[model samples]
Target: MQSDSDRTGLAIGLSLVALLLFDAMGLIIKHLSEHYSPAELSAYRNFFGLVPSAIALWSSRAWHAKGRQLWMRQWKVGCLRGMITTLAQFCFYMSLGLLPFATAATIGYADALFMTALAVPLLGEKVGKARWLAVGIGFAGVVMIMGPGSQSFTPAALLPLVAAFCYALSGVLARRMDADVPSPLINLYGTATSVVGASLLTLALGGFSGIRGPGDLGWIVAMGMFGGSAVLLLVISFRMTQQANLAPFHYFGILFAFVLGWIFYDEAPVDDLMPGAVLVAAGGLLIVWRERQLRRARLWGARGPHTRI
Candidate 1:
């Protein structure tokens, strides 16, 4: 019975909460990085994260309406996304251990720009000059944060950039999936694959370290809960409204990351994140705005000229 406006407001609120939960997971990952390898953490996260994905799938009315089908026409796409997600988590989690919390997170924002670029070849979508310009602006901001050739820049900085690209690739692949498949089901596929992939990666990386204490174990559980819940909320939000309506708000995560970093780690990398962060946000917002404009144009075109304003 909720109106479109009410659904949009709820979606936006849920999206914000999801972002906060994701940041909370990141905080826990950063805290535990000293005691665990990224591979181990990735494996643990995906393992526990599967619970929420399964629960979401089970709770989906649409999925239930479909007679609880377990098969997907694009199962390969889901598997590929899972593999990519495994790599993304490994790289991002590694960066969280090595870089400033905000720095790693800001760099990860490059995923938006990467997604735009990848959509062209990967999705066969046309890229307009405006969006390409936005990508350039965003890339420049990413480079500013990386600070290559500066003393502050290290090889470690590249980890988050790599992570961003993998994440973007995974997202782009999702668009190639069958539209009829439930998002929660797709998510479950990816998470399950990630679990296996991360486990193998952990074995290859010389295996997991022993937990130092129950505190670390508790933190691991909290990390998985935060991440899994975030994914669930994001899935629900996307279903509630147009993705473009929610896309721009993702930048809020960067601000939250910065605040959390400052509070927890006394990290205030203003000089490193200043105008660059502004440019990054502006570029992403511009892309979102352009997408919305194009969608509206398409809608109007489909409705014909006689449609009411």
Candidate 2:
């Protein structure tokens, strides 16, 4: 058996590896965008992703519990989450193709800000003034990236913001339904939803006409494998240690995305977007800090007043 300290270290290591793998998927998606539509690539991602999800489900014995269905108790809610996740990923993949990786990543990370606001209605969670302030700062960071009313505004630049909103909504659903739904089932349904949705949209757009060769197939499969593996690693990491300890490491993906962007695509954020990225990063850190404080307070309160006898 691993000690708590050993598990924590392992979690941290896994978290870092997961983030890198996620960035690798993003890089692969960006490269494949030259050969396929975002919708088509999304289909590929979800299709191949199902393979690992099935493996994880089988390995964990999550497909069927004692006398329970695979859909768990709340099948409707799970399906709704799946639909929301599909749209979120489609928007994100589109933005990945349309914008610089660093810029797209900065905006996508703003989903944390969206989630804070959405939590008020969805989760019935109270947002303190500090968190609201963090949310404001985060949105400001987004505007800095967008440069509203400026020549820097490309319609496609808004795709990531849409993606962020959809992601936040999906996260809200996931939190609400997490009690009854196992992670594997959640992943399975979500990937299935994406595959079907993307396929429908692609067919409506005139089918997969861009698939030129096996190279395209290879890129798509690689993207899917990296994406699925990242989710598995992230799930394991969170289960291993305190989530607060792992929360900060999420920003590490942005840094890696920037480095990867520069190296492969020779891409760099513009002057304004770079500053925006800094602000977004800061705001995200503030939110994480505030959450940690809240969690600690709850734990302390649960312990009752410490009698300094």
Candidate 3:
């Protein structure tokens, strides 16, 4: 049998790969945003992304063992999540087009802070002083990157911040889903809804623009595949180990984004990201540390103080 440590190692590897794929998708979106509307790009992405979700659902052994159940109890919640995700994608894609790649990507990290704050009201979770302080620190970093009063700051910077909030809200709401419903199934519902929502958004935004060229078409397809495959890998990683084991590694994504932005776009925003990015990372790590402590405490309490380690 595979040891717990080995499984965790494998899960971390998969998580890192997933983050890289997600960053690749972001790169493609940034590249294509020059010619396509965010609404159209989102619609195309969801349409192609549905294939991987379907494949993941079909291959789910647990879902298959339960007779391939297709319906979920929280279908409305799934749809709402999809709608919110569409908004998130639209905003983030717009930011990618308007701002520097690294800057937009770094600002989007605020989603972690938003997720932590939202958990209090959304999940009825109690917030301790440490986590609250971490949130404040993370927000301060976000404000520094945003540079609200600085001459360089533009309202466009707010797009990724809004995107981060919507993304965090969608994630927090996912916790309310029926546990018995397979994750892949829930993902499919959201992806399907996103397809419809994105389509409507495209129509509202004056319909899809003609594909700029064959090369752009190819990039769009690649973008969808990268996103879909990342989601699939994440599902596999989640199944293999505890989420907390993988959560901290998500910070690696900022590093990946920074490197990619520097290499591909010649964007070195050291001045913009500097100490702010450090605080953002530190704050998130602090939250992760506190969550681990609480989890360990709960486990110890459940052992009745008499169980062996």
- Give me the runs in candidate 2 sitting further than 4 Å from their true place: 61-69, 178-180, 306-309
**How well is each residue in 28-57 modelled by candidate 1, as lDDT tens digits?**
999999889999999999998988889899
Best by lDDT, which number? Answer: 1
Please report, in order, the local distance difference test score of every candidate based on alpha carbons.
0.94, 0.83, 0.92
**TM-score for each of the candidates:** 0.98, 0.93, 0.98
Q: What is the C-alpha RMSD of each candidate to the true structure, in Å?
A: 1.0, 2.0, 1.0
Weakest lDDT window of 10 consecutive positions for candidate 3: 300-309
Expressed as tens digits, the lDDT of each residue in 144-210 for candidate 2 is: 9988899878888789899999988887888877564567777777778778888888888778876
| lDDT by residue for model 3 (190-222), tens | 889888998899999899888888898899888
Of 2 and 3, the candidate ahead on TM-score is 3
Q: lDDT score of model 3?
A: 0.92
Report clashes for each candidate as comma-separated counts: 0, 0, 0
